[model samples]
Target: MRQKATSLFAVLLLLAAGVAPVGAVVGTGVEASAVQSNCSFPVTATDATGTEVTVEQKPENVVTLGPSEAQTMWEIGGKSQVVGLTKYASYLDGSDSRTNVSGAGRSYVNVEKVVAEDPGIVLAANIVSNETVQKLRDAGLTVYKFEKAKSLEDIYAKTTLVGELTGNCEGASETLSWMKDRISTVRSAVEGSDAPRVFVSQGAGWTAGENTFINRMVELAGGNNVAVEANVSGYGKISEEVIVAQNPEWIVQLGAFGAYPKTDAYNGTDAVKNGRVMTVSNQNVSQPAPRVVYAIVKMAEAFHPDAFAAANATTTASETTTTQPTESTTESAPETTTEGAMEGDSTETTTDAEDSTGGTPGFGVPVALAALAGAAMLARRR
Candidate 1:
């Protein structure tokens, strides 16, 4: 079908958008520590390129080759040290002040611009090509290329490595602590709840599959990814026939442009029939940064609202008893409610809840009916 062809094209673009060159050196046998140790200057570590990278001292200025790298710097309180970044990172606060090292497109990097910044260190995302990195090195720059983040654990490791490289050890530790606590809270909230069949639509019928961060988020949020069930690997398109057969209870779209295709297969699904479709910010879900917890929490709250609300109440009560109450101590839990199910009406019951860091909440849907629908589908399939 024309829609299927478009979906395939979208996925191919996503793969190529990373800009990873053919025959790039892939990190082999790379392992990240569960807990970060002490922070010391002149630290030595092997990067994703299997090259020994040493930071002789704390970097005074750094350059980021990708938006995710820039976002990580902002999260760890090292934004001040970033003197340059790609234009894609413009969404970050005060990013306009940083030098733009972007080339003609989102995936291209301007080596001349990066060299012009004269940064003390350069942090490269996995998407950066080996030739680009080698060119920068030949120009007499110290560049550390990170491996692709496959899981939350991998993200944690990258955070640690970034902090160690930039000498922002304290900030990294604090960030990690916050991330772990939030994840633990979410996991506890959905501990015994039924997991609905969730289909993640990245627009144009593109779906996230196994070994991808989006898939991990769905699992963490207590939903089974339908793309994984269909045996779609990495970023790929799921056939319309397969979507109708699986009959997902919830459909989560990434980014503002994400939408369910207008077709019988999508229209007939329970997600469309029951108003269980929701959209979340692509920045929070797509980027491998600390903010990813926002996507996970949003999904969990939608997938299991009652359980999430109960857990939040207990957490608030516990915090109140342990510490003196302050004006900022109040937790804002987003109310979840069902609306009239309408086809293509994804924002009907969306709500926003501010996170602990005062970050704006992403879109969410309160989907209490998912459990019932999921159970019925399972019974029929059996």
Candidate 2:
């Protein structure tokens, strides 16, 4: 049992270290209206790499260097234009039909495959190295690299910019409008409610701090981030002592791989005792795309259920009276399976189980071993 625990702990650490930099979103300070007009050809804009790239015409074929970029393209109605993408983007629908441009790992780009695609434009993510971007450019390809997205505004700007680049301006506008409306609803719902103290665990001891999208999500969902409170500046490991001292009311795991470390410090927290633990899908929360609004809404519902429910009911009523309700407009609160656990593809909780080894319940030796193997493979891929 001890051996299993040790091995699991090691894997968790590896996940913690590997997870943060992959698809990490930060701000670029670029406005959505940086371009003059929508779908305008020969439009020139400076990318995150400080290079001016001009898209002379609508791209017939596009390539994405990261999952987030691919997600953005798909969201903005440019899916058919995506001719190449990395392996991590396999989760997207019909991605298998596109050529894989992944090199050795998730962040590495296969320049030769990308060149073969003969893409009209390449959308690069923050995770893509500058050297790789230059290599693509050296091969005479037009590449626009996005900086890290820090805030919701940054994400909005990126979406608009993507649409402009891909000649999907109308789609981008629609997506941004939807995102803003959802965000406004969440803010209104959580208004005047008490903000819970939230601790977001990526895995092991790593937590998101200031200048990260995860931290922004917590704040937007009307919860205070304990990592930010502890002065953790970026994605870094936090001491178990701080976690206990902060006493977060809610603990959020990033993905299926995310788990609270097996330690007295984590077990003694209010979140654990009361079972106020929730898991958000990695794709929605980690990627800086329009889908991040889903994570925000999920967190808002978890953190302030009463307020969210009231707000959601009001919105539904208004929609019913204003027009015929459509499937897209209809929304429901997330279903709770346990005291603090919710259920959905984007948000879920680990099923409760009795811990025989005095560790956290539902996270046993066997489970950890399995998670360890999976995380190791994921780490290698990322």
Candidate 3:
């Protein structure tokens, strides 16, 4: 886990800042500590990082340390509270004021830097060091170990917890409720209606299985996951025989591999022959960001093409009939950053994964790099 954490930070800093990888080992140092009394939630709780961090008071300065856990904070309207990140947790506007801490025995943010950030609480992923946490805790910093969110249930719980932790419980509840309602609506719309067989790929050559949140989204979108047909764990390989036999109607490549190479399918397979392949944004669908619900609508549009197209036609008609132009901040077209939208390597949009450009990785190849995204995606499913 430490190695994984270190590698993640190194990749982010290198790609984002254009800094070469530095040889800084993570460290351990318990600094002078003090506890202030301003407590609100519970006296103490475990974080996803498995640390038993306590809060004397509601946290004013927090370092979000999970994959997209910072997003949960943002959803609760508590962006102002985040004071630091493991890496890529800088999406919040006022986050520049937050410190970036690394490790010790290396040039990264050592314990000194963490102490310097002076965070009252550290929002962690499930994979940080207990020793490091103990040091922070011993130094009087409240270290709450956030459990890793795995399924749809986890997302709801995590959102609620983030809201509670950041004094934005109302926002959390509302957001989670809205998400659940929308998902339910989608499910009911397609429930027992002969679920369409669909295939979704994320990362290099991986497909979404029952183990992932995207699989749940697929079900909600009225599409059955082909990967889950095998009932495998995490990301596993699907043989060409399986594809030829099942013959999914839609093929979606999520995350960095948004584009499924339909042309590259085995001798023009059904997914390619049917022209059901489409590329999409990872932030909107894969990452549990603010736009996840929107992903549902768009994905539904993909599944029931005729109905969605008709619905879109009605929307266009309504807009055309009663549209009043407001002052548009985006007066000009956005400058295109990508020349061609490659299936596995294109970083066309300006989301979080803009700077991690490297190799083109896809089916059968190892997930050498996310090529276009720098966002951390560690999950604390426990």
| CA lDDT scores, all candidates in order | 0.64, 0.66, 0.48
lDDT of 3 by residue, 67-171 (tens): 255666766667788767543444334555766554432232245666667877776433334455566767866665443333455555556555655566556
Question: How does candidate 1 score on lDDT?
Answer: 0.64
- Cα lDDT tens digits, model 2, 1-382, are 5544444444432232222222212233346544334577876778756788989999999998766788788887899999998656666778889998876412346799999999999997654566667889999999987765556777788888888888998778767766776787899988989999999876667677876657878899999999999998766778988988999999988665557676899888888899999887766675667777888898999899889988887675333121111112121111110101100011101211111011121122333344466555555564
Model 1 CA lDDT for position 177: 68
Regarding lDDT, does 1 or 3 come out ahead?
1
Question: Candidate 2, which segments miss by more than 4 Å at Cα?
Answer: 1-30, 33-38, 105-107, 316-382
Clashing pairs in 2: 26-148, 26-149, 26-150, 27-150
Best by TM-score: 2
The worst-scoring run of ten residues by lDDT in candidate 1 lies at: 336-345
Query: How many Å off is the CA of 171 in candidate 3?
Result: 2.1
The reply for model 3, stretches above 4 Å from the true place, is 1-43, 46-53, 91-97, 102-110, 230-232, 262-267, 284-292, 305-382
Alpha-carbon error at 89 in model 1, in Å? Answer: 1.1
Ranking by TM-score: 2, 1, 3
lDDT of 1 by residue, 1-109 (tens): 5544333322222322321111212342223444344567797777766788888999899999766678778887898999998655666778889998766422347
Model 1 regions more than 4 Å off? 1-15, 18-38, 105-107, 316-382
